[model samples]
Target: MSEPVDPAPRGGGVALCLPLDDEQRLDASARRHGVRVVARCSGASELAARIPALRPDAVVAAAQPQYLDAALVAACDEHGAKLVVVAITRDEQRLAAELGVIDTLAEPFEWDAQLEPAPGGPAPAAAADEPVAATPARGEVIAVWGPAGAPGRTSIAVALAAELAGRGGVVGLADADTHAAAIAPSLGLLDEAPGFAAACRLAGHDALTRDEFERVAEWVPLSRGGMSVLTGIGSASRWPELTAERVTATITAARAWVSTLVLDTAASLEHDEEISSDLHAPRRNAAALAAVRAADRVILVGAADAIGLTRLVRARLELLEHVPPERVIVVVNKVRASAIGVNPEAQVRQSLARFAGIDDPVLIPWDPRGFDAALLAGRPLGEAVPRSAARAALGALVDERILESAATRPGRRGFFTRERRLA
Candidate 1:
């Protein structure tokens, strides 16, 4: 590999979130390095609010309030800015880099020499003979998505999450639907409680730790097992709170601690067309999009009826644009003999094979009575009616597919590398 020529002499902009002493040193260095200090924040809280408006090219801060949290890093990622954390000691420097900062520097260092790499450039390589940082184990993120028309997305997602919770290990269920969210009410959770929305805010400020996330995530009481849930907004108009960056941070942090994460997302994938010309305009489907993009597997749910099947096929086609086909699991919900004649499951499979080339799709039988009872009680289908046809079918899906996939998944390890304690 060869070094590329440096670009034009335009001064790069930076945002500072550092102590008084460190902040002053960074300022002096910025002047010496021909870089502009666009914004100065006393801490992470102020930094999170200012970074977006100033949109600096880089950010430098203390590692504690700096790189450890996903929110600040995600904000930097969205603004296309670089991050460099100041570490007072060698151990702190290693920890900072492990926490996913763009780069690390010891105090009393030369700023011009350290800022040599261009924005978006790869991190500086480790020494030839030195050991490299270990890659952390990443948990599985399963996103349940579908088009409009109540295709039973939430039911399948909740049922799947409940089942997985019983299998062992930690599981996180997130309601990421920006439009008309119902997870909280569906699960009998308190509508007034702060959940995913609050977690996103904390994540935005880089203040959400693993323990803090658990507090924001509501714990659901499953008859057979239990799982942690991050409920959706109380109202539809609050969609702006579930921005792509915040959603990504929440999910990323959840993955760090849990073995599996099930997400219930919105029906649409369309962005704001009226403001399409402006890249910063609010996207209504951002939560759904972020969930799908971050997922290891996407469970595509659709109704088994004619109109529902047509929408399912189209939705699958659209979903293919975002995730790989192999990673998608098709689930036909509310199957009934009257809708598609005798052997409804077989018919649905044939249709999918013909139109989308998807074989072995999971078909859930319609069970209005059981489903209605579960909905009224605000409990999972399995707990409300364990032997219900739909519930049994969903259980089979968990046994044959979801659980097996998560169990056999390779590289189950801690997300953060082992770091020496600070003296």
Candidate 2:
């Protein structure tokens, strides 16, 4: 065996997201490390935005909660660049591994170390026999979607969030609908700051801290404590701001902010812009698409009427194109004999099963009065009319869905774990 000497990395180009002082230190240490700093930036978002132009061989980013996240890793992979993260804590190192980094280095970095191991990359994990680290759990995201016509997506999402909040840890309700945004007005929230859009912006900059997220979100009081609310945009024109990248970043930032997240999304699922328009243009439905894809469970709500049933059938077929059928929780709302003919529950069930191949759909009986009270009170039906049959139905639906998943879902250390105090 011959001893190899002068091990330079695959390429000299490397992107660095560090302070100016550290940037200078890296410049001084590059020669010893056998790598060149191609570009130096202060934020992961900035580093990502420059990847295409810089075309670096590797990215070295600070392992802060916001800066070195899934979005940044994804951005690097999309550009075919390896990531070498600088982590200071056991949790951050765990996060780096979970994100599949090519290399991990301790902060303050031993740059003078003989650049050991592989030709270009730094060493991997610590020496063997180090105790395994447990990563904290992230909140599960649930997206409530429906077809074009009003099928009560917002109503269901609001109630679901409230119900989840009452059960335990902090819950988040995000109004992610691009067209006809309504969570703010429905909840009597002032929408003065446009919570969700602001959060998206902060996430893009890798500045979405726990305090910042809480500041942007309005607290909605429920029967048991309350949930944080990220009101929808004041108008649909701002859809482009919620890009797929930013949406992904926001969801990652939110993992520690709450135990459960409920997103009320738009109806349209068309992403045909790539074929019809410029490939690089901002997508209008990117927010909804991102939410649906990121969700642990998607609740497809359908108004139990003749016309609504037709739309649901078509929408479910389209939704299946994006997510697996098992990942979706089919829900038929406002079920009543007057709208869907005799035995509305049976009719709705049979229609869904026959047309969409959907079995075991939850049918919530019509309780207009309960919903009306909630609307007037600027609250969820569960909080406004806890004893209503509709609320009870929603409770059972959530219990079944969450419990079923909990039985099989992989467990992680509790960062935001809440006591199971179901109301």
lDDT of 2 by residue, 1-423 (tens): 111112432332666776557766876777555555566676677666766655555566767755576777766666655555565453454455456442244335434331323434333322222322222256678999999889899999988887776653356889888887889988899976789999999999999997788789987765554678999889778888888898889987787656578999999889958566688888878898999999888999989998888998899889989899889998999999999888888888888888878889999999999999999998889878889898999988877876444321212111111111000
Q: Candidate 1's residue-wise lDDT over 218-332, tens digit each?
A: 8776653367788888888888888899889988877766667899999988756555887887788888988998999999999999999999999999999999988899999
Q: How accurate is candidate 2 locally (lDDT)?
A: 0.72
How well does each candidate superpose onto the true structure, as a TM-score? 0.64, 0.64
Poorest lDDT segment (10 consecutive residues) of candidate 1? 414-423
- lDDT for 413 in candidate 1 is 13
Task: Report how far off residue 115 is in candidate 2 (Å).
Answer: 57
Give the number of colliding residue pairs in candidate 2: 0
